[model samples]
Target: MKKLAITCALLSGMVVSQVWADAASDLKSRLDKVSSFHASFTQKVTDGSGNAVQDGQGDLWVKRPNLFNWHMTQPDESVLVSDGKTLWFYNPFVEQATATWLKDATSNTPFMLIARNQSSDWQQYNIKQNGDDFVLTPKSGQRQPQAVHDQRRSGRHYPSVQRRRAG
Candidate 1:
């Protein structure tokens, strides 16, 4: 009876591990297809109580290997660009541009995981499919949850290309 229990436990463990591996693989496969992505976004900032504090619209462009450009056209005129090495935030209204290391800018943002496209990083998130959305929760318990909803009609949707993060 002891041996039977042990064998069953081992088999169950393998099944669970395989399921996780498959989930990760599926997510990675989707992300790998995203070489460049462009989108127009309307963003609303809300407080903890769900009161709208600010609203804005912008155009976003991202290319693989760490290159992104964000242009805000509503509520203000500003631009955030990353050329893989440095991140530049420019505000025409203030007539100022601030530059920071890309690594530093990406540290706390989802862009880090998406632009890096590292499988190791994928392991740090628990990924599951909810209808048409893929939800990602940080395994480290230090970050907010993010969901990826791809509007693409063809091919698998990945993390970086057309991801909508909802916390």
Candidate 2:
């Protein structure tokens, strides 16, 4: 019975691993086909209790190999730009702009994973597919794990519905 349990566990692990590998491969293949894209999005962030915390709408332009400009126009104003090397964040409401290396920004932003084409960058997350949608969840031991993982269809790894928990 013990051997049976051990074998079952190992087989289950292999099946899950295979699924993750296939999803990752599919994602990388999809990313490679796109060089750039532009999209408009409305965002709502909620707390752990599912209460609305903040609402926003924005336009985003993403270029492959690490370049993007995210402009938020609602509920205040801000812009985050990455020049393939440096990450710049600007807030017109506060008149503040901060700069950091692109490497530093990718650790926390899921959008960074989409902007990146390398499969190596994706290894940090587990990818699961649901029909046309693929959900990417950051694996345990991340710098700061997010509680909600968007169920966005692989339409560039960003989902139409977003929910975030306030820390």
Candidate 3:
């Protein structure tokens, strides 16, 4: 009986892995077809206790192979620009702009995933569909510090910028 139970568990694990692989492939194919995208967004962030910490609005622009810009207009003004090779972060209130090599910026970030076209990078996250949304969890075995709910719009596999509430 114990042997049978172990075999059943292994089979179930394989099934789940296959399902995730299919979802990831579909998402990759859809993302590859998008050459440019623009969207306006409103974001609300809460603390661990679920208290509202910040609310803001922004606009996002992405021109693939790898150009991205995010302009935040409310709460505080800030801009993030990536030109395929480098990432620049600027805050008007602070009068400072910091620049870093895109390769060094880490692939774990959502914006990086959108800006990067490599399939290997996308594979770093385990993606699962949840009702009308998708949940992405890192494959590194570390628990995600926060939850990100991705709601697909206009029948696209990837969530629109408006639905990406967490950065």
Candidate 4:
């Protein structure tokens, strides 16, 4: 009886593992083919009560093996750039530009999903289908909420990845 129970538990875990990435493959297949891409994005920041705190529109450009330009133009102006090594964030209003190592910036951010097209990148997060998009939450149970939009495929232009961090 104990042997049978152990086998059942192992089998169940195996089955769950195979079916766990319902959204991972979908997102991977959709984005893996592209070498470069760009998308326009609109972001809304809200509080716990869902009240809008800030809004911004931006253009995102990315290339494989870590390279992207994130430019925000609406409500304010800021730019984030990564060139396969260093990451830079510039705020024109504040007249400040901060630079950091690429690894540090994308360590827990879903931007790694887009920047690094590797199985290892997807392994750190749990991706589950939420409606038309997928919500990527850290496996460590962090509160960072990120959405990888997998819109219908059309050449190199895939769906824009939008994320909302909880306040």
Candidate with top lDDT is 4
25-96: candidate 4 lDDT, tens digit per residue: 877876777778888888876664566778889898888989999999998899999988999999999899
**Once superposed on the true structure, which residue ranges of model 4 sit more than 4 Å away at CA?**
1-17, 46-51, 153-157
For each candidate in the order shown, give its overall lDDT on alpha carbons. Answer: 0.70, 0.71, 0.69, 0.79
Top-down lDDT ranking: 4, 2, 1, 3
Worst 10 residues of 3 by lDDT: 158-167
Displacement of residue 26 (Cα, Å) in model 1 is: 1.7
lDDT of 1 by residue, 57-117 (tens): 8887888878989898989989999998999999999899999998777654455555667
Query: Model 1: clashing residue pairs?
Result: none
lDDT of 3 by residue, 1-167 (tens): 99999999999999999988876666666677777778787776655455667888988888886698989999899998988899899999989999998788755654555666687777677877654444566687443423334445776544342122222
For TM-score, the strongest prediction is 4
Q: Model 1: runs farther than 4 Å from truth?
A: 1-20, 44-55, 74-76, 154-167
Model 2: per-residue Cα lDDT at residue 1: 100
Compute each candidate's TM-score over C-alphas. 0.70, 0.78, 0.79, 0.80
RMSD of each: 4.3, 3.7, 3.6, 3.2
Q: How many backbone clashes does every candidate have?
A: 0, 0, 0, 0
lDDT of 2 at 125: 74
lDDT minimum window of 10 residues, candidate 1 = 158-167
